[model samples]
Target: MGEMRAAVLFLWIQCTSGWMHPKCQIYDSGEDLGHFLKWTCNYLPRHAEHYTAACEDVTAIEEDLLGLPPNINTFCISMANGQNRSMSLGFFSQFQDLEYLYIDGCFTQILPTGNIHLPNLQHMYLIVKWGMGSGCCNCHIGPHTFRNLVNLCDLTIQGYRLTAMAPDVFHGMTQLQRFIISEPCVEDLSEILCRIMNIKSLIELKIKAPEIQTLNQSNCSILNTKESMKPVFNNLASADFSFGEIPHIEEGALAWLQNLTGLSGAFSQEVLLRLPLSGIQQIQYFSCSGSNEIDIERICNVVFLLSIKKIHLANANMRSLSMSSVELCTGLEYMYLGGLGSIHPSPHLKWNFITSLKNLNRLNIDFLRDKNPEICSFQKQPITWLTKLTLLINIQILFAKQFSCLVTLQYLDLTQNLISNIEDFAFMGLTNLESLDITQNKITQINANTFFGLHSLTWLDLRNNPLIHNIEAMSFTHLTSLKQVFLGQVNNPLTEPVIKLNLTLIFGGILSQLTHLYISSAMRPKGYMGQRVQAG
Candidate 1:
């Protein structure tokens, strides 16, 4: 009895002396200090307190304070400098609130394979960057790795070089909604693709696997669906690839994308086969560059782009526009075709393409100067059928062609191509043209009657074009409705020598309406000097 009393007294002194400095293992920096302290008390390590009582104290907090009802919701194990990094499976089973877990740095391979049964973890982020460790093996089985994340809604796994997930990485994650993989060197994105093949309920998945600097070269195989399972992803809404790139899925692999109402990408002509929509009903905005290749009919009907309001197809080798290509698109309002390969009008091509588009108000056709050095597919009748239009034509180098009759055209974009010489008959029948943009082109000369029939022309943008050497005194004389003129390239050396408007004779009153005059950089300054000489 005396010895027992002395032991209790000794423990009392130790607990009082050493309990002040608590060692908390798992924590979020964003948590408040008081909350962290409260949590720390539950996970704190005791240095000396009649070890049994210390353990009892921890259990009391785990049960009473954490309110853990024998269900593990979280687990955290620290890795010391020299200790083996694998935590015991018993440690994981001790707490009922073990839904989330984190193991820092590297880990041993033999920690415990197929040892997890966590069904409650809805959001998880694993930060592992292991090397050739002895605790794990080249996994090739099911009910393993991420075996029991069945109810997991969000899972994030990150590492420098995680070779590959177990074949059944997401074997039973039936209710999983979001999955994220941030390993830069996830050379085996295909493995992950296969794992999620059956997760039809997953709505959002983001994959990001760029080349990691520290990883060695690795080979990955093309993904294939399981033979017995014709899994359909009817519920998926959005997917983001690891590197903003994906292997072009086979012909019908993207039949599932039909349900996705919104998609965002800079894909161009060659990758059009990736969008395999069989019955999409609500897609609207599309963006692409020169390399995208998608079928116009497939995109319009099956991809359900009737809801699309804006389209940007620049430099996409688009030579002709067919009426059926845009038949079902009722919501299309703005269209951009600049950077398109062909600029010349192919009269032999169909002209009724834009005639059916009732909602189209803005149309842009950029020059081919950047790729072909000249415009080759500019058809005038393509613009004539569209009853109302805001046109933007950009011709970099000079090429003379008679403008087709476009009576309903409004705003015109003629910027950054080869239009150095302006012909009097170029814009003859454009009666409703309100704005003309010939910026950043090769315009070195102009005729007095260049814009003869443009009675409604209000704005002419000659900015960034070498305009000083091109403007004749009569170039601006006729357009009585011209209100705004943007001339002179920003920082042009000649703009310093010539500031006053010299073309007052072409049409004197037309120059007086010029209220918004911008010379490169006024309210905003395009700081760099353009290489082309504007005959300054």
Candidate 2:
């Protein structure tokens, strides 16, 4: 009887010491005795469906994964040390219903070659860290690596030093749509495109290669010639080629890609002129920066053919920008002419060219330089003739009753300028202005009629300024439709303490409609008698 009693005590200790069967559906190898016992006692009785395991050695938890419920659809494994690890073939073959599998920070040189059938898996991301050694140069892909994943739509293979891939590496992925290769060590662009052109359903392709210099005809002849045996990229809609230097694309290089709507890269004028203009008439979005010389005449000659709608020129020499030259491309709706600290347009000629763009919806002209502001000057000029435009930036100051013709202006950004004072009725005709950003300026105070006619304004950003002391009671009275206001960091704290604002007198009746308000902690007033403000 004494021996029997000792056996019962041993069984009691085993049950209380946090040792449960693997079939309990929640296995945490990293948990200590106390925490494991608490979880088993509190959470295990409800029959938790999900299972999670954290192991110092990932290989030891491979058997425990098979004991999970068969209906488990999501599985994630994170390795503690990712120096040299290998995933076993057919390791995940049991969980056929799994839909998502994410393996992060696992160092694998090559994927195992075997039929690891996952018929229902839809998404998979394998992010491995290639070790710093000579063994990384031997990394490659074997055939039939992902042969069983028939339903997989998105596949991303990143952080690998792949030297070569077999011809049939992606042979079975017929339904794949999007493939992204970012920051890879691959050199040849034509070799990669030749392998993936068989994917007929691909719509978007983006390659961010920082090491590549040129993409001339020799490397891109696959797209130029028509092959009856191989398929072309007929369904490709958008392509972004962001190499370091200006890639020299030869004539008829991208002529067969009829559905390509957007193309972004830096190219020279001579190379751009060599392209088949009649073949790329459907391309509406083009963003090209000059690498050799900023020839405005060459830019006009190229833009006149494709009928571009939106163009962004960076580091461009706009000295030849004239009314007759800009009128060639009459279909432009949005234009961003930046890095123009040296090209100053005459006020009369600039106004004529701007008014001629009848369909223009947005225009951004930046002239902020390192020197003391002598490039573009419009300190006290009469602003007129922009009835259809909706957005403007960094043109000049907005005097009272000067912008009465710009009735359609809704969004305006005049940040980082040399405007110190805004006279009364400065924004007199901007009745439909919804959002305005005037931060990083030298404006000191606000008067009663500063924003007199902005009735439809909802969002206002007035931070990072010297408006610390004076703000009249009716300064924002006309902005009854204001919903959000950002007034944080309005004073230079290095020179003075935070300024206290009278919320009752500043917002008045408009405070009831404000849904979001941002203010500094030190600027909160004491003994304030107003409604409780909502913080956004």
Candidate 3:
């Protein structure tokens, strides 16, 4: 082999390390990415067939026949960032292995201006936006022209301005399994998405029109989506039904969302009501985001939630959910319940709500203080402190001691509370306590041996307070595992000799084991003496 050819082959070996050979250490081009690409394809044309061109914004991948390897697998041209005078499109068509294509940004001359027929192509992503008229104005993938990619499996397009998607736009991808179309509101996604069922093998369909706003073009007053709903998919597992603001949603008529494990969109009571819960036995994720009145009760009735592992009911008017059984959803994992501005987080209103989530590893209960007047009321103790700290909340009274379930509790937050002093044995039951935070509170003095038996305690917070003074030497002696202690506000006693901080108890003894300590500016070690009190 020639020296240059050998060098290229070696570069290819480096480029496909994990994919080609586990032991081979290929070359590292460092800052020169173009050099790496040139050397790689030059030496290993056979191996180059595996380089998926799924993210090439042609404008950014300016190549004039120099980068095309005959056997390339994927060629995704996502050009959403800048102008597209063919960032490099003038010469990238030669890569025969292109499969998944994801293009974004403006299009000038950098677009596939002709019928793109790459046999190995499985996924095609074409995102066209306002990038029209410069040089991109004349480029085209005309009706039924690019349908020759029969082996395509997945396709995604975002922000393309072509008004119509011919009936056979995706007619040739026989092996297609997943297809997605994301575009601006100016063009209808239904134009491209409605024909997916033709690919028989299509199992996953995603229509993410995040910034696209749909306007009833035909009548301007009413919505006519029937043209895109007739074809039913038997294998679709996930779908994305999102757009800007939904002007109108047809109730009791979502015929297309019957057998899905995941669903997201501007849905109303009807969509959540008739959802085929019986067929979706493995639903782990659910989102009802957007300004919609979701019938929390009707939705809870979808017994399939019993199979749900994680649920996101964000941005909806969902009041209360009564999930009262460990057997109800044994596989339940995580729950994010903070969309209802009026929904308050309280176990008392309905503690039976999540008791059944046996496998629940994480739970976030967020209540809008602006919506729930009750949250604004300053009570003597933290409102929702569950005794069974088996759950995690960062408030006052609802601490571990309040519940038997807290045995598994690892993190405890006591910020901005009425906790004045570290009560003796306050942490006695917290056998698993790893970190403790008492920040933004009124902690005057840490009582003697305050952390009596918390041998596993590592982090402590005593910041943002007023009366903190005199750290008793024996206070944290039992905390052998204590690594970093936050006492930045500890009354500096080094200044006043008459009222010196009993450093003999702190530094001279066991407390010396502390590696990190924070002290305040007011009290000195020599003259530290003052009326320290934890203000409520």
Candidate 4:
């Protein structure tokens, strides 16, 4: 029968070139459209998820000029400029149901040749282009290059001058669980910490390779073994070399990751005043930053580890942080110290070490270069399991019960704090505050008990106050669960000067649970705001 008419003309050219129909018919010529590779191919009117193929002057990559769509499962190959060829992803083995894979720019090598089996590869990114050819140290990693991605699970590798890699280049990823390497002139990390310490299903590990200056005792001697030795990262919990400049880290180079519990790096006040507190006594989320002046009582006796609970110190200038130095941590529950420089305002901030943190819940104190006036007293800091408070402190005034001990504050950020005055019951015992951000302040007027006892306030941000020119029409009538408001201004509309907000007598009866009302068509809105649209 003439071979059944050649199998019905090969299924009619695989259903109109869609290779058996997964919805595909896009051959775009979008982008610049000049020096070759300027491409595009978007199609999804019934299946096919994710397929980029962005190109521009790319030197080599030819899978029939990327006629993608084999049931695409996320695949992006963006490139701009190329040379040191050796590319050969074996045409991705015809996208056998591929799974997330992104490759960007200037590659000098990436040869997953031959039988490139991908068994549903799971997440893989490779971003190059750092000082070009031979600068990212010839960007090569071909020891079986990802050995047929046997279920690879999350693997990122950004090059900024890579070096010392190739320990069988992640042999046959046994389901690697999150492994990131953002190189910054990769300066030897002892063969990448002895090849991901034999990745025992690695669970989160970030390495920023900042010139890897040092980690003493002669390159972490295989993490100073012994103690029965069996610790191949039994599901490594979290490790971030904190973008190394490695001041010093000897004492058992990270106490054999005994189930390490989240730890960041870059600490140098002489390494937290001689840190080695048994190598982070079972750390429990500890981030650190440095630039000097950090003696917060010897880093609170070395990270007050009783399985500490979250403490992120930034830039480290921490002036006079005394209250017996964080009153023995008390299993802190999230605390971020700050610094942007200019500090000399510690007038009084002894909220009795947060009333001995009975499990304090979230508190960020950023001193955006404190420009003077600083006194935030809470008498007996009533952290009733505080919910979330961010203060960019410089403070001008918020007197009357300034945050009445945050009666369960649920998110409050005093952005760019220079507040001009929010006295009368200033949020008196916040009846469960639900998001309030006093953006860029120096307020001029919005009184009517200035949001007294915010009855479960629901989002309000007085944006960039170019000295608000009065707004007291029952100033948000006890915000009956107000729903979104951001009176915007100040980004130099010619040095700002415009105010006419009368949203029906300032949301007369809470304006029917107002659903988002952002101002700033040069702050103009005098009444009638029925169905959105009140000014430019």
The number of the candidate with the highest lDDT is 4
Cα RMSD (angstroms) for every candidate in the order listed: 14.4, 9.0, 10.7, 17.1
Q: Candidate 2's residue-wise lDDT over 407-454, tens digit each?
A: 677887767765667778877777878888777777777788888899
Q: Residue 243: error of model 2 in Å? A: 2.9
lDDT of 4 by residue, 5-100 (tens): 422122214232223212222222222222322332132111235333333344556622355555556455555554446577667767776676
**Compared with the true structure, what per-residue lDDT tens digits does model 1 show for residues 188-259?**
444455556667678887766653211111112333334233334567777654243443434444344443
Q: In candidate 1, what residue range of length 10 has the lowest lDDT sum?
A: 48-57
Residue 473 in model 1: shift from native, Å?
Answer: 4.2
Better of 3 and 4 by lDDT: 4
- Which candidate leads in TM-score? 2
RMSD of 4: 17.1
Deviation (Å) of 409 in candidate 4: 18
Show where candidate 2 strays beyond 4 Å.
1-83, 102-108, 126-138, 159-163, 217-231, 275-281, 290-293, 340-352, 367-397, 401-403, 490-500, 522-536
Error of 2 at 203 (Å): 2.9
Better of 3 and 4 by TM-score: 3
Which residue runs does candidate 3 get wrong by more than 4 Å? 1-93, 96-102, 108-140, 144-154, 161-163, 183-192, 210-229, 240-257, 266-283, 290-296, 303-309, 315-333, 339-352, 356-359, 368-404, 409-536
| Ten-residue stretch with the least lDDT total in model 2 | 6-15
As a TM-score, model 1 comes out at 0.43
